[model samples]
Target: MNPKVTDYISSNIKWQKELEIIRNVLLELPLEEDIKWGIPAYIYKKKNIMGLSAFKNYCGLWFHHGCFLKDEINILINAQKDKTKGMRQMRFISVDEIDTDIVKQYVLEAMANSEAGLEVKPKKNTNPVVIPEELNIQFSKNEKLKYKFNEFTLSKQREFCEYILSAKREATKQSRIEKIIPMILNKIGLNDKYRNC
Candidate 1:
């Protein structure tokens, strides 16, 4: 067992027992236990099989490639159905809801699926760059900003686009664009502040 995972479970005030029950069940499988995303992630053949976590309302397991699992029993739930394609979760509000034998069956099935090479293809970001109208106008008028924005990677450009477009109000969007123009001129990514030193 990962000591971090053990500590995480024991430290949970609301779902400690529920988390421990799921952890104990997962530990019995062939999957290697490791800590990932600050939770217990089980792996087989170095591929993520499942991860255990405690949410505010529920404790559950996220099956990494769960889209490929045959849900004849229909135990899986698409937590983000529209956005999440490859992953699925099984949530439990109480420890009694965790049927250990059934969970073992699902775990074994996930292992088999992994062994069979079933997988979800990664989603491609295929849409063209979504430059806001204000930013586009600015880009056309300011040659330096235009040159710097064009010099940025596709991801960096998309990051700026998403940041500006995520604003709900037109004024907010304009304000965001104005705020980022200097950063663009400095050739900085929108997430530069959060990047590691």
Candidate 2:
């Protein structure tokens, strides 16, 4: 057992017992345990099989390649319906809901899937970039901003455009535009910082 995962389980106030139960069950298998992105991930054949996490309303079991699971009971959910394609989550609201038998079965199936080369590929971001109305208005008023925006590649431009378009409220759209102006002028992609890291 990884000490970090142990500490992670013990330190979690909301889902400590739940995490430990799931951990104990998974530990019985061949999966190597490790912390990835601050969550306890189970690995097999050097690939991530599943991750366990606690959310505000529920604790979740994240199957990295869950799209391959049979999901006969139909519990898996794509958290982000439109955006999430490959990853799926099985949510649990209470300790009693953590059926060890079902979990073990699912995990074993996931391992088999991994061994057989079953997989889901991430879809490439090839959709045409639609510059939000707000951003076009900014370009109209500020030629320098337009010039800077044009400096980035299409992908980067699309990222910024999508970022603004994702905001729900009018004020939020304006706020997003204001935020990206400096980034655009500095020739920074919206996700450059994280992507570089």
On lDDT, the candidate that comes out on top is 2
The top-ranked prediction according to TM-score is 1
Give each model a TM-score. 0.75, 0.69
> Against the unseen true structure, what C-alpha lDDT does each candidate score?
0.86, 0.88
User: How many pairs of residues in model 1 come into backbone collision?
Assistant: 0
User: Model 2 residue 47 lDDT?
Assistant: 92
User: Each model's RMSD to truth, in Å?
Assistant: 4.0, 4.1
> Candidate 2: how large is its RMSD?
4.1
Clashing pairs in 2: none
Stretches of candidate 1 exceeding 4 Å from the true structure: 133-153, 174-197
Clashes per candidate, residues 3 or more apart or on different chains: 0, 0
List, residue by residue over 1-197, the lDDT tens digit for candidate 1.
77877888888879998888877888877778877766778999899899888888988989988888887889899989888888999889997899988788888888999999998877668789988898999988998999999999888899999999899999999899989999999988898765521
Q: Give me candidate 2's TM-score against the actual structure.
A: 0.69
